[model samples]
Target chain A: MSGYWAGILSILAINIIFAYGIFIPVASGQLNLGGAGFQAVGAYSAGWLSASFGLPVSVTIAFGVIVTGVIGVLIAFPILRTKGVYLVLATFAFAEVIAGAILSSEPLGGAMGISVPGYIDWYVSVIFAGLVTVFVFYLMATRFGLTIRAIHDDEDVSDLMGVSVRNVKVAAFGIGAALTGLSGGLYAHSFSYIEIQGFNALVSIYVLLYVLLGGTQTAWGPLVGATFFTLLPEALRSVLPATKNFLVTLFGETGIVAPPDESWRFVILGALTVLMMVFRPEGLVTRTMVERLQFWRPANRGVTQ
Target chain B: MLLLQQFVNSIMLGSVYVTVAVAFTLTIGILNFLNFTIPTLFMIAGMMGWALSYYGLPLGLSGPLPWPIALMGAVVLTIIASLIVERFTFRYLKTKYGDSTEHAIPLVSSLGFLLVLENLVRIGYGTDSRRFEGPDADLTMNIGGIFVRVPQLVSLAVTVVIVLGLTMMIKHSRIGRGLRAIAENPDAANILGVDTRRIVPVVFILTGLLCGLAGALFAINYGEVSPAMGEDIGTKAIAGMVIGGLGSIWGAVLGGLIVGLIEMMTVHFFGADTVQVMVWGALLLTLLAYPSGLLGHNTIGKGKL
Candidate 1:
């Protein structure tokens, strides 16, 4: 593969894993906005372990996943106490705190960032992404997933129906964190470097957007969302300049014919997000849409279930 | 005396935070929606003001206007942008499914707007920071051996007056009563004769006014404007909003000031690198330990997303 394609594939794989990490919590009715924090914990832990202790890649990645999972569970208890906007704010604050802590810690290399010794190629991350996708799908098919869905539908009613809302939420959050950590570890190894700036609030927001816009209904959502959004910029890279050239040709000569800015990609994404919410707030791949595709039942076209 | 000067400086910084925090708190408080575009709105005012003053109106409409006029034009543009955001996000909030994550639609759309507006600005104006040619921000006054920037003092007073005015308007005006009713219960207020659509736009208007004013003040005080300016101040404002407790104006005020104080003190003692850690750490602690905040009502922001 060309270097460009390889780079794109690696990013696509990492984003898919990261999206699922966020997807697990959102599916369980929790908006884990501090995704970058968990991912950072995973990446930095793996980086530090490899750089400082010279641990093997496998062990360090495992350590990263476990440590991030544990921290997620620890943070989940207190954070889950607040619901809705407070919950979102709490998670955001948690990420900022993690970033802040990472940036200031000396052994972690602070703002200088740490470099990992162990390196991995694109295939490794792709394999991990595939595994995580299957795992999440399997998870969603189990009784535990049913309980999470129940809790997501209505917490109090689920509680009345004998569901342990708190435990399920914490479990989902932890699993999501672990998955996000795994992706981060892969990112560090794949890129061969890790920095705090790479995992800022914007990354969290983008990952969450992938999950939310993809459809939180099923595991398919994140897969589709991640792939589409990840490739979108690459697609636009050629399209934007061509469109600008076309405009310039059509308009002859004018000051308005300035070269297209790279930021147009984000602008397009943002516009799509706004339009999607207006026309299809439920997301692009919803439960009903998935069901219709599977069953091919014309009568069930508009029926939700 | 140096500590005292730091304290005063913190207050000046806090004034900006307080304005933005109130803008954030107001939306969350009344509409029960966390508008992510707020920071973008703030940035718009500053960047637009700079653009207008430095380059005049786009397309040679006129020569560069005076700074104050430019700021006024920027504030007006920001209000229009806020209204545009409201039309898209808030207006389309309702979903037929009514699932737990239904509330996230507006939030997600606002995130889209955040990305769109901010990046559009980046495209229109280059990514680099520009010097804002405003009144001399260095004019200082010495009182008891403590130095205070004259512009900072004026801006601080303006912030105080605006907050007081907003509080009084929310407390005593008919519109305020309607807003309070809507905040208490949107459907109930609608049933009782409050125009949900009309009153909702009012919140966005106020949000734009507050954010624009804050952004203008920041430009004058800091003497620089940039596309990325909002991310730092916006996140800090969010921390202030949470620390003060979501949905409480007074809580936001206290929270903004507390955040400013923490930021200045951290810079004084631990260097600027640790400020993020301290401010975010304080926010995380507040969310975990006292979600209701100092002056916030416990019920606000607890609604399921």
Candidate 2:
């Protein structure tokens, strides 16, 4: 593969894993806006372990995942006490704190960032992404996933029905954090460097956007959302300049046309998000749409809600 | 003596945060929607002010106007942008799935607006920071060995007056009563003839005004404007809003000032690198231990989103 294609694939895989990490919590009725925090924990820990202790790649990645998962569970108990906007704010604050701490910590290399010794091929991340996708799908099919769905539908009623809402939320969040960590570890190895700046608030926002816009209704949402959004920029890269050229010619402008700015891709992404919310707030791949595609199965057989 | 100087400087910095925090608190307080586009609106005012003064109107409509007029024009532009954001984000918040995550539609949409507006600005103007040619911000007054910048003091007074005016407006006006009713219960307020649509836009307009004023003040005080300027100030203000508590104007004021104080003190004690850690750490602790904030009502941001 060309370096460009390989780079794009790696990013696509990382984003998919990251999207699922966020999707798990959203599917369980919580908005984990602190995604970048968890991811950063994973990346930075893996980077630190590899750079400082010279740990093997797999062990470092595992440590990253486990540490982030433990932290997620520990924080989830207190953070989940608030719901809705407070929950969102709490998660956001958590990410900012992580970023800030990482930026200031000396051993972690602070603002200088840490470089990892281990390097991984693009296919490794791709394989991990596939495994994660299957894992989430299987998770969604289990009794635990049913409980999560129940709580997502109505927490008070789910509580009345004897569902352990708090436990389910914390479990989902921990699992999500772990997956996010895994993605971050992969990102560090794949890129061969990790920096705090790479995992800012906007990264959290974008991943959350992918899950939310993809549809929080089913496991298919993040896969489609991540794939589409990750590729959208690359697609736009070619399309935007062409369109600009066409526009310049159409307008009969004799002056030299400046090359298209890179910001247009985000503009399109943002426009898509706004339009999607207006026309299909339920997301692009909703439950009904999925059910409709399964023509062989009886329509009412699995309609839980 | 130096500590006292830092305190005064923090108050000035906090004044800008106070304005933006009020804008953030007002929307969440009344509409129960977290509008992410706020920071972008704040940036718009500053960037627009700079653009208007430096380059005049787009397409050379006229020569560069005076700084004050340019800033006023920027504020007006921001108000219009806020209204447009309201039309797209809040107006389309319809619950189709009747799920907990459905409440996030507007929030998600606002995130979309944030991306769109921010990127468009980046495209229209380069990402580099620009010197804002405003009134001299360096003229200082010495009081008891503490130096105070004159522009910052003026901005501080303006912020105080604006916040006080907003408080009175929300407390005593018929519109304020309507807003309170809506915040209490949107459907009930609609049933009571509150004109939900009309009242909703009022929140956005106020948001625009507050953010615009804050942005303009920031430009004059800091003497710089950039596409990415909003991200730092916006996040800090959010920390202030949360520290003060969501959905409470007074809480936001206290939170904003507290954040500013923390920021300045962190810079004084631990150097500039640790400010983010201190501010966000304070926010995280507040969210975990006291989600209602110091002055916020308990029920404001607790509903399921």
Q: Can you list the residue pairs that collide in candidate 2? A: none
* lDDT of candidate 2 over A66-132, digit per residue (tens): 9999999999899888899989988998998899889988999898898999999999999999999
Task: Summarize candidate 1's per-residue lDDT along A184-227 as a digit string, tens digits.
Answer: 99998889898899999999999999998999988899999999
Residue B14 lDDT, candidate 1, scale 0-100:
93
Q: Highest DockQ: which candidate? A: 2
What DockQ does candidate 2 have relative to the true complex?
A: 0.87
Clashing residue pairs, backbone N/CA/C < 3 A, model 1: none
lDDT of each: 0.92, 0.92
lDDT of 2 by residue, B1-305 (tens): 88998999999989999999999999998988888999999999999999999999878799998999999999999999999999999886778767888988899898989999999999888899999999865698998899999999899999889989988998999999999999999999999899998898999999999999998999999999999999999999999998888898988999999999999998999899999889988888888888888998888877645
Which docking band does candidate 1 fall into?
Answer: high
